[model samples]
Target: MTKRDNASQSKQFSIYLRSTNEWIPVTKEQYKEHSKFYGSFRKKKQDHCKCTCPHQKWWFCNADCETCKYRTGGDTVSFDFMYFNAETAGITPLEFLESNVNDFTIDVDNKLISIEIIHYIQDVAPFILSVASMRLKGLTDTEIAKKLGMPRTTLLARVNKTADLIREKFPDYNV
Candidate 1:
């Protein structure tokens, strides 16, 4: 292929928007900015943009983004980037579904990875993250318990609880 043909082949195609029933004539990379711009101002279910809160006007002290409530999030509700990217790239919906990249494996035994799993675990069972990470670093339950200064039984209990949660969230997967 010529240099121009190669360049064109490497380019991303437009995506079809279900909401407006229009084709977004932009590559996936280009859509990043477009999605962010539109996602921020995108209307919510209540017909109000999430940025209704005046972020520029600080209400209280700001230590960093971690403690800052004014920090805006990316447009998750407005656009399905994965679906759009796959469609624009001329991939089938089923192919897209099978090729998920949002998961992380802790070990060969329990390949635990999913955005929902991570978010829920972080929000509700935060301690599990420490346990999982330590275990992944080749630490035994006893060593983890000693390092964390918790009882081995307690550590084991939390691990079991985390496993239960994973099973609950992903029934088909062998946690």
Candidate 2:
């Protein structure tokens, strides 16, 4: 694989949550807990592909491309991506873990908010809110869980649950 392929590998943990249909960043530790595929990331014959389908700058294809067999896409093709979720984080995961409970809302309409929506919400569980904030800052799940004095998987669950809440309450926010 080339540099771009390596970049894609780096983005594996970068998940697109079921709540928001956009790419969301997650900690490497969280990826390990929720998804168990990174350690097994070895080179394989079917690791890549080049399709001749109609697409623009990487918009969604009609489910007919075979560039890779990542989970984001179907078995018929090989393109994949990630998305993420949840409460508005005013402070940060590190801060929350350190006993800081500042809840700040990232404006729903802010253009940059879409990059990480969890940091821009209001009213949510403290743990989940902290997890989202830490994720926005690009910390791995393991790191957050460790600092917050919780198990890795537990943190993952909290983050996912928060994402579900966001999806249910603000479907129009495009978070």
Give a tens-digit lDDT track for model 2, residues 119-145: 434456656766668989999999999
Q: How many clashing residue pairs are found in candidate 1?
A: 1
Which numbered prediction scores highest in lDDT against the true structure? 1
How far in Å is the alpha carbon of 172 misplaced in model 1? 3.4
TM-score of each: 0.35, 0.30
**Model 1 off-target regions past 4 Å?**
1-113
Please give the distance, in angstroms, between residue 14's alpha carbon in candidate 2 and its true position after superposition.
Answer: 82
